[model samples]
Target: MLRRLFGDWRPTVLDVLLSLAVGTAGLVESFGRQGSQPGQIGDPVPMAAGAVVAGTMLLLRRRFPVTLLLALIAVGLAVRAVSGGGYYAAWHFYSTLILVHTVASSTEPRSRRGFAGLACVLAAYAFVQTFQHNDVAELMIGAVFVGVAYGSGILLRRQMDQTLRLAERATRLEVEREARARRAVAEERARIARELHDIVSHNVSVMTLHTGGVRMRLGDEHARERDMLLGVEQAGREAVEELRLMLGVLRGTGAPGSGALQPGLDQLDELVTHVREAGLDVRLRIAGEPRPLPPGLGLSAYRVIQEALTNVLKHAHATGADVVITYGRTGLDVEITDDGTGGGPDGPGSDGHGFDGHGSDGHGSDGHGLIGMRERAAMHGGELSAGSVPGGGYGVVARFPLEAPVGVR
Candidate 1:
């Protein structure tokens, strides 16, 4: 309640009206109680009239402060007239005090300064009248009124300046908060876009290429080729299922259900079989017993193997490859090496340094593909390294922490 009264526009307006009313009431009482005797007091009618006129002027002060000041001056003069030079002539100064307040609050600084000068002139005139009538007490009261009104105006001006500065600071803080929120939302959208391109584009392209190969081989009508076509069909179906699971993760549908099996370290045999059928001999070896891994690590492991084999087909042109998996107390390690000579002179089949800078499209994996692999490994608290093997072959080595592997196990 106090905040509403002191901090808002309505409260200021009410304050102005209340101060004017109090000043008017004081004037009225002073007028009506005048003694009307020589050097004793005078009639009350003049004071009452002055109070009414000043109060009426105050009603329009916010809109016309100059007019209100003029009206206050005229009322003070008329009150003195009815008093026959014996009334407490300074009573009207209370109304002048209120006029100063209204003018200071409502008018421009220059206009308010002009009103202050006018008030000083009026105070001097009242001082002359008091000296003429020999009323020392009324003269002192009038002088105090003039001093207080001027002081109050100065204080109110400082308060208004402070209020404006505080409001500007609040507006600036709000703008910065809104800008930060907008930037966070934009960054989230960009991340989603990158994920969609990485997941959907890579999966769909692989499916399309394998499908075309199956069609071409079916046209040949060989029994062994027919078996390869069947294998391709099975692989394509599994790819579709994997794509659906990834899409579910993106859409906030939660991880794939227990019924959906995603390839992990245990599925290395199947991965090698698929690559071999694709005309690359990939041998799989597991050095230690497999343990259940967190879903993200399993998925990352699957994708790394898939990308490595894809690179063998697209860049190696190798007839065979070796895949070695090792389980340790701290983590799992995977290494894929292919004896394909499809990359350039310094390709993955050259010296060990060849594939270091081949993450770009120069290798089978595009720049984004390697970035996706790195991100996946990091997600599982792991690391992945790719380079040429000791011989003329490409090698990819990955290690996922055993204690933790992306999200809750």
Candidate 2:
């Protein structure tokens, strides 16, 4: 508490009160000693006046320390001249020591050195007085007290400076840590994006070529199958286009083409259709008015839905799934659920399909699809969660803010 009260080294009400007490006590002592010796007495009024001046000057010491010290010194000289040079109060010396300490601790090095010289002059004057009175012991004690006060002030000042420097260093380290983390996240995102581009681009290109070949061989004899192949080919083309757009974003390119736009809620129906063609009955239900969304947020939302549906087709043995999209003024929410076997189509013993059990053989079955979906969501300031539902199915849900952060595009 004392440190808090004096931490700034500024004078406050408490300082004023303490100075008042010291001045009053000194005045009382001077009065008490007036008749102690034949010619050692001084006028009570001049002594009290000097003490009052010293205490009043102390109040302004923090703001105008050098000026206050000079004023106090002048008052001390005037009081001695008025008193005929034989008497001095202990509190007067104490007040001078306090001022000396304040100057040492608060001023710049050059100003402090100048004040130290003035203080030495004052000390020498006092010493000369002590010598005239043959009070060697008193002189030694006063000198030691002043030296200690000044030394303590210098130490405190250095400690405070060091504390400030340490605090600044800590802040700098925290900033550097955050910068490093952001760089790592960006690098990881770019790496994942490149891998996705390679995988999806190759698979989609092959699917498009095969579909076109099948349709050509059929030659309109089986219109229905040819139409289905045509639909698949169109979906593959769209997927390739969207992938290109996403790659452009990941690679920090402005856009893949002059008129290209990131796929969003508008293309959700086509996405569901593609999954249905893959042998999973999927339905999309959207709630709320459809409006324009930020490009990044839209892409993230579309990818999340795509991954969820893909998982359903690959693992869920059930014949149907549902996707619900609810849009709010500030955000969008998506939920996808399937009625397939809660674990996998192949039952409990099966570790599901995929390389590591994420979903598809191309990916992993552990949770790669979910992880990628979640990363996409989070990149746009969103969140995603996936798990088996209580009754008997797997579900995935995601929420995204409507507005993208500035500079996201």
lDDT winner among the candidates? Answer: 2
Model 2 lDDT tens row, 1-409: 9766457576689678858976887788677767646555557778777888778777766666556666766787787888765676666776777776776566654575656645653653464354246577866776687777667767777888899999999999999857755555555467446555755676678889999998989965699999999999999999989887787777675422322344667898888888889898898888987777755567678877877777677666668999999987778999988887745644555434221235332333243455567677887788888766888777888988876434545
lDDT of 1 by residue, 1-409 (tens): 9665335434357556755775567565764456645654456655666666666655555555556567666666666766656444444555566666656655445675566655644654463455355477866766676667756775786788889999999999999757754554443333333344344545555776776576665655476776776677677667766765665555454422232344556676777787788788778888886777755577677777776776676566687888888877678887888886655434443433233223322223322444555666776779998876676777888888887434535
- List of clashing residue pairs for candidate 2: 354-360, 356-365, 357-365, 357-366, 358-364, 358-365, 358-366, 359-365
| lDDT of model 1 at position 163 | 96
Q: List the residue pairs that clash in candidate 1.
A: 31-44, 36-41, 36-42
lDDT of residue 373 for candidate 2: 72
Q: Each candidate's TM vs. the true structure?
A: 0.47, 0.52
Which stretches of candidate 1 lie above 4 Å from their native place?
A: 1-32, 39-41, 89-91, 108-144, 221-409
**Residue 158 in candidate 2 has what lDDT?**
83
